[model samples]
Target: MDKQIETELEAAAFRGLLTHLQNHPEVQNIELMILADFCRNCLAKWYAEAAKERGIDIDYEQARDKVYGMPYAEWKDKYQLTATPEQMAAYEKRQKEKQ
Candidate 1:
């Protein structure tokens, strides 16, 4: 594929992923981290880094809003659930395994 075509395809796939995440608010960030080792925050950080690579100045919060479909605080208030003890334990186990 041509470079431009490849880039457009990649962008389309990313948008699809973002849309899927937005439609599935029940899939908590902790769950994503535990299962996939990356979450919305991770995506936001990556997005900000990409912006920096392109000589753009996008902060974490701005990237997060783009990912979360709202301000981080508002998203947390509206959709974030408290992780249970079991969830925390699983997360810790996953972190340990990564190290």
Candidate 2:
């Protein structure tokens, strides 16, 4: 495929992923970290970094709002759950394995 088509397809895929995540608030960030080694926050950071590379100035918070479909604080208050000890242990083990 050509570059433009590739870019459009990738952008569509990203939007789909963001929508899926926004709809599935029960999937905690910690679980994402343990299973995929990345989370919504990581996506926000990457979004910010990508904007910077393109000479845009999207800050982290702005990127987060876009990825999360709401302010991070509001999302946390409404959806984020306290991690269980088992979840924490799994996350820690994943971190160790990555090293």
Candidate 3:
């Protein structure tokens, strides 16, 4: 495939993934990071970095709102649940192993 076409396809796939994530608010970021080493915040950071590379202005909060489908605080208040001690421990263990 041509490079431009590949980039477009990747962008489309990323949009689809973002849409899926927005619809699955029950999936916590910690769980995602623990398992996949990336999550919504990671996506937002990537977006901001990409924008910077292109000389576009994309702030972290704006990028987060895009991935989250709303302000992060609103989403957290409405959908985020407190993690159990076991979940926290698992996340920490995974992070340590990742280091």
Candidate 4:
């Protein structure tokens, strides 16, 4: 495929992922960190970086709001759950494995 078409397809896929994540509020960021080593926060950071690369000014919080479909604090208050012991252990193990 050409570059333009490829970029559009990639953008569409990203939107789909964002929509899926928004629909699944039960999927905690910690769980994403443990399993995929990235979460919505990471996506927000990446989004910010991309904006910077294109000479756009987007802060992390702004990018996070776009990713979360709301302010991060509000989303956290509404959807974030305390991690279980098992989840913590897995997260720790994943961190260790990364280093």
Best by TM-score: 2
**lDDT of each structure?**
0.96, 0.98, 0.94, 0.97
Model 3 worst lDDT run, 10 consecutive residues: 79-88
Off by over 4 Å in 3: none
Clashes of 1: 0
Per-candidate count of clashing residue pairs (backbone under 3 Å): 0, 0, 0, 0
Answer with 2 or 4, whichever has the higher TM-score: 2
RMSD of each: 0.6, 0.4, 0.7, 0.6
Tens digits of per-residue lDDT for model 1, 2-99: 99999999999999999999889999999999999999999999999999999999999999999998898998998999999999999999999999
lDDT of 2 by residue, 9-81 (tens): 9999999999999999999999999999999999999999999999998999999999999999999999999
Q: What does candidate 3 score on TM?
A: 0.96
**Model 4: runs farther than 4 Å from truth?**
none
Estimate, for each residue in 1-99, the C-alpha lDDT of model 3 and write its tens digit: 999999999999999999999999999998998889999999999999999999999999999999999999999999888998988999999989978
Any residue pairs clashing in model 2, and if so which?
none
Q: How far out, in Å, is residue 16 in model 2?
A: 0.1
Q: Which residue window of length 10 is worst by lDDT in model 4?
A: 16-25
Local lDDT at 63 for model 4: 96
On the 0 to 100 scale, the lDDT of residue 29 in model 4 is 98
- What TM-scores do the predictions have? 0.98, 0.99, 0.96, 0.97
